[model samples]
Target: MIITSAKLFEEILAILKDEDNIFVIGCNVCAAKLRTGGEPEVLEMCRRLEESGKHVVGWTLPTAACSIRSFESLVEKNEKINEAFCILVMGCGSGVSSVANVAEVPVYGSNDTLSLGGSSGGKLLSEQCVMCGNCTIGEFGGLCPKAQCPKGLLNGPCGGAVDGKCEVARVNDCVWTLIYERLKKIKRLDLLYVIHAPQEHGFK
Candidate 1:
């Protein structure tokens, strides 16, 4: 899942200041799960737009905005979409771009994509993928230390974890500890002996 946070309402208003007729779009999957671009949020956006003197011609929700085809299919069916002068995407950056790529009107995002991550027990987890480009996750039992660790420890835990909790973010589990447990469960503890080269920063 892609972690996202809503943009300030004032920022959104400013972005749409020159546009009078608007069409709102939301994502039903990642953005919905995070409550950043869900049905309720989309409706709230429409209400706010109308209150601000913008005409909301239509609104639609696609399952996953990153999946361009799914968004395109739903967008093609919206009758009132053509009436809008611009589009407000209550989803990630990719979703906003997806609308821009497929739609004829201008598209803008109302949410900021933070990171690639997952959740546990109905709560957001610390686990994430930074897309560093260099591949080393296989050595850590499918977990990337470059992403999950605050210090981005590649060899092992920094030995600062207390009771399996991270030293930097005490509420989160130590990622290296999680890696070790995963390796042990998979009978790949020998991977700990493998020294990894430094990640190439050229991708940035």
Candidate 2:
């Protein structure tokens, strides 16, 4: 998901202030969950921009703006989408790139996609999955040491483990403990005794 900042939004507004007609396109899939560009967000932005005296030509949210096929259909149905002087994209960086590929008009951004993470609570989420391709959970009892460990260490217990809890947060469960349970369930508890050496993994 992408992260949006107030400064970024102000800068975007400054750029489009001169334009009369503008289109604010949002993505419903990842961007929505990420709190970046969903349909509701696009509408809120439209209202604010209209208040600023810019004419909002049209606004719509696509299921997955990054997909070429989905965006193609959205563009076909929303003919007035291109009628605007500029387009503001509310998806990740890939969405902006895809929109630019299919349109000749100027494109803008409404958020910054940092990394993939899930929601923690109401209007709040955190970076849990770092998207490190080299996964050792299968060998580590399926507990994802990279994500569960407080230090994200590949080796066994770190100094941060305190009384079976992580030093970072007392409420947080130990990653190794989770690993042990998962390993035991799969009859691979013996694998926990073996230490895994860190190795570089490259993205495809």
Candidate with top TM-score is 1
Tens digit per residue, CA lDDT, model 1, 28-142 = 9989999999999999999998998889999988877776674448557587887888989888888888878888878899998888888878878534788777676787998
For this target, which candidate reaches the highest lDDT against the unseen true structure?
1
Query: Model 2 clash pairs?
Result: 2-113, 3-112
- In Å, residue 77's CA in model 2 sits off its true spot by 2.5
Query: Which residue ranges in model 1 land beyond 4 Å of their true spot?
Result: 70-75, 120-123, 202-204
How much is 48 displaced in model 1, in angstroms?
1.7
Query: Each model's TM-score, in the order given?
Result: 0.85, 0.73
Report the lDDT of model 1 for residue 104.
Answer: 81
